[model samples]
Target: EPEVTQTPSHQVTQMGQEVILRCVPISNHLYFYWYRQILGQKVEFLVSFYNNEISEKSEIFDDQFSVERPDGSNFTLKIRSTKLEDSAMYFCASGRDSNTEAFFGQGTRLTVV
Candidate 1:
């Protein structure tokens, strides 16, 4: 079974620094999304991408955050300036369609100091 894979399972960065979290979603999936979970909080949707453009985004996905497909196989989330509140587990998920089951990656834990 194909699955999403994220690099650098954990990352430590200083506040105000930039971080790029990478993910390779399932090959056949058409919709991709980025979500973040603050320590003990619920998973929050950041943004969704389809057909090489942003389909939707939440308020948490402010100007500091950006998503890109970049190529045929990889999806990425870039945080231009990290803040203490940016520390969380970022998950990459994909599905064949919005209504189908989405598969998630192990997630990249980002720590902002």
Candidate 2:
């Protein structure tokens, strides 16, 4: 079975530093999304991308956050400046369409100091 893969399963960064979380979603899926879970909190939607453009985004995806599909196979989330509150498990998800069940990656755990 196909699955999403994220690099550097765990990352530790200093506050105010930049971090780039990377993911390779399922190839055949047409829609991709980025979500984050802050510790025990519920999973929160960040942004969604399709056809090489941002389809939608949540308020949490502020100026500090950006998503990009630099190539056909990879999707990435960049946090320009890290904060202690930004520490969380960032998940990459993909689905064939908006109505379908999304497949999620194992997630990248980001820890800010």
Candidate 3:
């Protein structure tokens, strides 16, 4: 069986610094996405990347955010400038197609101070 893997698991950063969250999903998966949960809030979709470009994105994915696959095997999300409100659990997910179920990583807990 294959699953998504995220690195660092936990991260603490200064409010003004930049943070990069990494994830690796099943090799055969074609769709990848980033989502976040702010403590008591619902899991919110940030962006979806497919075919090497962003396929969809939520308002939450503004100018401060960006994502890329630096290598064919890894996907990453970068926050240009962290904010206190950015503290949350960020999850990486992947699926075979738009209609298929997505498998999620445990998540990287980010804390900004």
* C-alpha positional error of residue 77 in candidate 3 after TM-score superposition, expressed in Å: 0.2
Query: Clashing pairs in model 2?
Result: none
lDDT of 1: 0.96
Clashing pairs in 1: none
lDDT of 2 by residue, 1-113 (tens): 99999987999999999999999999899999999999999999999999999999999999999999888999999999999999999999999998999999999999999
**What is candidate 1's lDDT per residue for 1-113, written digit by digit as tens?**
89999987999999999999999999999999999999999999999999999999999999999999998899999999999999999999999999999899999999999
Q: Which residue window of length 10 is worst by lDDT in model 1?
A: 1-10
Kindly report which residue stretches of model 3 are placed more than 4 angstroms away from their true locations once superposed: none
Residue 96's lDDT in candidate 1: 95
Q: Could you give me the TM-score of model 1 versus the true structure?
A: 0.98
lDDT of 1 at 109: 100
Report lDDT (Cα) of residue 75, candidate 2: 97
Model 3 quality (TM-score): 0.98
What are the root-mean-square deviations of the candidates from the true structure over C-alphas? 0.6, 0.6, 0.5
- Give lDDT: candidate 1, residue 26: 99
